[model samples]
Target chain A: MAETPVRFGILGCANIARKVSRAILIAPNSTISAIGSRSLEKASKFASDNGFPASAKVYGSYDAVLDDPDVDAAYVPLPTSLHLKWAILAAEKKKHVLLEKPVALNVSELDAILQACESNGVQFMDATMWMHHPRTAKMREFLSDGNRFGKLKSINSSFTYEPGLEFLQNDIRVKPDLDALGALGDTGWYCIRAILWAVDYELPKTVTALREPEFNEAGVILSCGSSLRWEDGKVATFYCSFLTNLSMDITALGTKGNLRLHDFVIPFQENVAPFYVASNSRFVELSIGCEPSPSEHAVTTDLPQEALMVREFAGLVGAIKGRFKA
Target chain B: MAETPVRFGILGCANIARKVSRAILIAPNSTISAIGSRSLEKASKFASDNGFPASAKVYGSYDAVLDDPDVDAAYVPLPTSLHLKWAILAAEKKKHVLLEKPVALNVSELDAILQACESNGVQFMDATMWMHHPRTAKMREFLSDGNRFGKLKSINSSFTYEPGLEFLQNDIRVKPDLDALGALGDTGWYCIRAILWAVDYELPKTVTALREPEFNEAGVILSCGSSLRWEDGKVATFYCSFLTNLSMDITALGTKGNLRLHDFVIPFQENVAPFYVASNSRFVELSIGCEPSPSEHAVTTDLPQEALMVREFAGLVGAIKGRFKA
Candidate 1:
């Protein structure tokens, strides 16, 4: 028998919601049931522009989406200030929460959202799409191998893009009232997450921020960097900027080998990604050149990473519902 | 008409001398005339093993090599502590000096060597082979283009190698008396040089050393890192180690583009080297992927980088000799 597809109700017609809504339609185990914005016309236009299914409802207010009986899950891509209010309300309505990155303005707000989800028995996940990439899993295998890539000694990550003058002047990311964390929260989130992922999610013992951070007139960070040191002498450094050209890179060096890739956050191509690895690289005779050069490993995926993320999230929701029915 | 070749007398039988000797023989404008060691037997064996010309002289003492009339230049690959003595003597003897890196124990010693070379009108050059590679010039062109790669925003470099336990225990790089600066002077030199090269040799306004540097029992640094900031908000970071797998990388991010290369100090192959360049990279529809992805540029050279270094030094010596004779 085919399992019932989890129905998703998207909160707000945010730009990112267009991508997630498409992912819901593509995932076999999920479907878009409704989309709500502050205005019915905006929601209707968004649904029409993004090609929402005819069965999907459009709501004028976010509350209507939460109240919809067909919405088993709510994908919240609201501004940072509104995440705390809407995410908690969705959980209380017995809706699983798929929140956008920078889940909340602060840790306490995130904690409150988590508590509400636990009490209401609703699943919660941040929409970090790259985590579901098959290439990430392949890279992880190389890092976990002791003989090929021993204990990681150091890592460096950078995520930067020149979003142009119009975005810099008008984007919510640059406004202190909307996305307060700015580039640090928007782009640095990936860099910090990458470092933690390389070390198996172990928090660094010490974190020192690099000096000379560039900030806009509204006190929003335009560029910044930090150095993190682990208890076992492992070191990591990252730089995130809104003023540089697009570049997402991660370089992890180990005692026996190394791993490097330029497009870690979003691959150059959606279906295929490539990473370079070198093991036991040694200088050739007379030190004229290296003996074993790094080789590129390209991994292909049938579905987009966002679709994979949705499938994984919907599967979890289905398991919870099955347990309750049993 | 063929210009007179620069005849080189190599001081000491250090392992590095073996590579430089071959480069001297390969370079069209340079040739090995003599080699010196503490023992005549060792000097003769080194000459035979390195396949030096049968007409080349073997001296038991370094003084004899410096004093030889036929020695137009001296390739000094002695330990750091002895650089001040040998380099100054070579310059005073009117022989152009091609000295290895970490040229002195301190700035004063380096100054004395420079003063001697200036007074005697003898050409002086450090044996940093990668500086002479054609690929370095190609990468510089990308960085210099205002439309392609605007003002540099940040750069990160790393030079590391796992030389095995035997080298860690017994190598002169780990000995305080011979090479007190240790990995900082041996490997970090390359990282620092790369950062300077990217920035057009402009000095940084401030430099702060990263914490948790590894040290040997003799108080020699095995691994370390530092962050540098320029007056115009450009930042650079570098890490160098003797305990990690061989990785020499340079990732420079600019306002409009980025330049990245895995083998910066030495190419994976002596004949060809590659670097990646990305200009005006932007995310495609719905930010699913990036467009105008990084492209690789490969440069080929007939002679190895070391031979190019020797040839450049020989050309400089020939020019200086021409000036003196005029």
Candidate 2:
């Protein structure tokens, strides 16, 4: 007999859910038990399209979905402005949560989420899909090797897109309730998270910023340059932008040499995808020829790594069920 | 009749003198009439090698060089550790001055140097060679053109080198200084200045940094990453390293396109270097060329664009002499 799959319920039919739903379907030992949206029609459509099991249900309200006895965990893909509210509610219902990136609109929100999760004894993890990719693990290993890149010197990274007029008109990304969740939160967060992870999440000693008041109507940043100095004298600088055309690059320089990530904003894929390593004044190319682990098939979606993230989430759920043993 | 040339003196037998001395020779209406060193033998040797006229003087003590009435301006290149003391002494002697980069150890020292020049009514300019290059002017013009690159998003720059053991041991760069002058100040300053200048020197709202503690013996940064947010929402990042092998590259991303400068640091030649511009997802080769000013040709040197800087300096001196009427 197969092990029972963890039943997942998604809160809100967020735009990102389109991508997350696909991951849930393909994730091993995980099943979509239900879905909820403000509108019953939307919830039903999402459940039917994904072919949720006959016993699975659809709810008009997020609270109804959280209260479902069959749902073991909740994936919170709410807008930045409402992430804290739904995440706290999910925790109150004793549901494990995988909150979306930016985790919360601000540090205070993050703290509140932390407190809620702690009080309820529920497992919580920020749903930073990029972080879940095995390539990120590869990057960390490369950095830790010490003999490869040497002592860390600086980092330069960017993730930008040309979000067209439709997005400019109605996307919550432009709304005020989110409070500084524009480029810095929506896209720039990836660059920030990458740096934080690369440096073992060392808090920066200082931070200064500039913002485009016109585009950043919510006063979040459209493009920002930040310098972070770690206690060990390691430094990094990163840039994020919302108004520019597409660009995703990360370059790290160290004492002995440097490493370049050609498309850091995206996941590794089989084929001509290439990164470069520089040492002794010459550059060597590291190309992706075979599919990297977490999935056997060639990645086809814009975020092909999403399936791996879901699989990992299922494993974490199993660990929790097994008394927190990995 | 030709206007009287400003008689000049150099106050140290430093490597930088090779370039500056040549500039003095080619500078319109200027002549190198005196030189001084800690040892008379060294000073005489420099004077003899350059075929100084019999009327030209050589002095054992730097003070004697400054005391000469024929010396209207003085070039000082002692050490990164001793720029301020001599610059002040030169000002006291009523001589105009050209101090090498990192004009003072830190911003405080820089401010003091500015005050000294203002108080003495003497022209003072930091010899940041690239800042005076004609190509830099072209870059400024290109960036400012709205029809071109469009709204600026990000900047990434680095300047690094691998000095031999002997150079490293004897170099003032390795010594202790309070101004964080090693990598960040020495080589990194070029990247910083380039970013600052590209953005019209807009003061950053905040700055956070990290430095390598090992190379920063006196706590000077050997490698650093700085994040800067301009008031207009533009972001820039700068990285510098003394430990890495030589490499220099600068990239700027804008809304409409992107510009990549492969060898921004120590460019092969002063004029007509090739760069890549990507617009509308198509890459095009763009040649950035500059006409050598007549004054530049006068000062012959092989340090890429050193002669161009000399010509600009000569213009600045002339402008100041004409009461800031440039």
- TM-scores of chain A across the candidates, in order, are 0.99, 0.86
RMSD (Å) per prediction: 1.1, 9.5
Interface RMSD of 1: 0.8
CA displacement after TM-score superposition, residue B169 of candidate 1 (Å): 0.2
Please compute DockQ, using alpha carbons, for every candidate against the native two-chain complex: 0.84, 0.15
Model 1 misplaced regions, further than 4 Å: none
Q: Local error of candidate 2 at A295, Å? A: 28
Number of clashes recorded per candidate: 0, 12
Q: Write the per-residue lDDT of candidate 2 for residues A15-54, one digit (tens) a residue.
A: 6786677777777778889899999999988777766777
Q: Taking the tens digit of each residue's C-alpha lDDT, what string does model 1 give over A1-326?
A: 78899999999999999888889999999999999999999999999999899999999999999999999999999888788999999999999999998898899999999999999999999998889999999999999999989999999999999999998999989999999889998999999989999999999999888888999999999999988888887889899999999989999999999999999998899899999999999998888899588899999998889999999999999999999999
Error of 2 at B310 (Å): 7.9
Q: Which is the leading candidate under lDDT?
A: 1
